[model samples]
Target: MVALILILVGCNSGKKGEAAAEQKNPKCKVETSLFGMTPEGDSVMLYTLKNEQDITVTITNYGGIITGIYIPDKNGKTTNITLGFDNLEQYLAGHPNFGALIGRYGNRIANARFSLDGETYTLAANNGNNSLHGGVKGFDDVTWVPEVISCDERAALRLSYLSVDGEEGYPGNLSVTVTYELLMDQLFITYEAECDKATVLNLTNHAYFNLAGEGSIRDHILYI
Candidate 1:
């Protein structure tokens, strides 16, 4: 089950036009701060992820989304290498790829319904008669209280959310904590949860990457 969670949760677009845009203005020095919020008052924070080489990644608390990744290519030039929408509205609308935290059962459970104990429970069908990430509002879509951790070398933002009973048709109230730690070369994610009643839980962040730092990684190289 954890393996499945790793797949959906464990982890973009333009190239030419992007280079032109970057030439106009080199990106500012990477920084960390509170970005903004939703009309509903949900808080969003941003973190800068740096690699051993000082390559950077910009991530936001909104849906735990990755807004940008600046990596040094073979030539040592920094390029924003991840795919994502320009703003929160686009993210709220929908996303096929880019970055998103998945939850309440990361993958399909067959027919958007499951049987727990002696009773059967049905979930909202958000994905073709199936439930995708705890119905309409999953853990990824909620705001979490954030704690920023830092050191001279790296940084992390610990985030957590509480899911109420009947939220997205799931049983039991669940308290979940997810951590985003930026290490030298990897964004280590930790997800922990507890529930008052029996329920299913799956969590992962969807982030496509190209370690080489350019182009679609699908054709770059893949194993498993």
Candidate 2:
């Protein structure tokens, strides 16, 4: 069995700036190209990040979704180890959260409401009586602006989005950015966000992995 570790953080603060320092002799290559267009005529793009070690990941800005991940097995052969559609239509049509960046709240909120500062805020009941993943049109359903960052040792794609005040019944106008870095034998994902007002915020990357490179997880072992 393979173990996957996800780090999540939520913070409240004023505006902050971040910079990615470039490195020399970088071992990764990043490329971007047109993927498809949305019904609203918005153009979507596909980002490909490949490392010197033969690991590759493909992502799209449509939903900040990872379309595929390629890794080599013991025999020195490489294959995609994640499940996803072949094109944008399949993703736009509908599917589970498959390889998406989930937010403004990653999990469920009981009764679709939460209280803050002695005031109760109502949310969309997306799941039964609970609010799930920021309600019907969370971050996973929106397009994000993307920028490529490179360093001597790695290359990354930084995606940014702005969640307006009262969007999906959540308070505060939030500014969010998620970066996906590709390195030899590893992939690093980092998320940062700041809100203008007091609000509930949770974020996560939803990527289902099949370490064996295919089929059901019946043979995969689990921990925790």
Candidate 3:
């Protein structure tokens, strides 16, 4: 089994944008609601996690996508910093991965194939001759099973999925679980996976952000 964690902390000082909606509940909590239905007739649900600091995040079961991340600025005005579409249709039609979970390989596999255990395996070449982001339908394109977990002073959403052997030509019965937690002023994303056979796996969340909230980030300086 392999475990990986990603963290996003709320900044005390940040850009300006629309104000966040006021919450009726002051304590940390998680709420569920219907987001939409897939073309295949699957029900997609949304999970909203709110913390004591007034930071709220909305995530959807479809693709484990984060629809919004509302954080307050120094002046107490809150706004969403991530870029994503409004409905499932837009996501189904496709956008640049935006706020979605990426896996079992995050980047391209050159020539749409790989050799493991001295045997060559072919993969779907979605990106020209290369297999991009696990090829054709990645983790970002699947619906995940969700469970609510309890944490001291925090709220969390755990999503799990099983990628059967030979999925997308990969040789493994892979069990993947990802957890999104709201602790204080931070949002933590933890990824865990176990494979029955030797295989390749890389996972990450694709979230496009504008720290300034709306304007171009040309003047922004990136650190690492």
**Could you list the CA RMSD of all candidates, in the order they appear?**
9.2, 4.8, 7.7
Clashes of each: 3, 4, 0
For model 2, how does the per-residue alpha-carbon lDDT over 71-166 read when each residue is reduced to its tens digit? 888898887878788899999898888899999999999999999988889988899999998898989999898777755566677789999988
Clashes in model 3: which pairs? none
Mark the 10 consecutive residues where model 2 has the least summed lDDT: 11-20
Better of 1 and 2 by TM-score: 2
lDDT by residue (148-198, candidate 1, tens digit) is 543334444556678888888889999887766555555567788899999
| Candidate 1 structure lDDT | 0.64
Return the TM-score for each candidate structure. 0.77, 0.88, 0.88
For candidate 3, give the lDDT. 0.80
Clashing residue pairs for model 2: 23-151, 23-152, 24-152, 26-152
lDDT of each: 0.64, 0.80, 0.80
Candidate 2: stretches off by over 4 Å: 1-27
Model 3 per-residue lDDT tens digits across residues 1-224: 01124854221221111122223444777778888899899988888888888888888889999988888888888988788878888899988999999988999999989999998999888999999988899999999987765544666787889998888888889999887887777788988899999999999998888866778989978765
* TM-score of predicted structure 1: 0.77
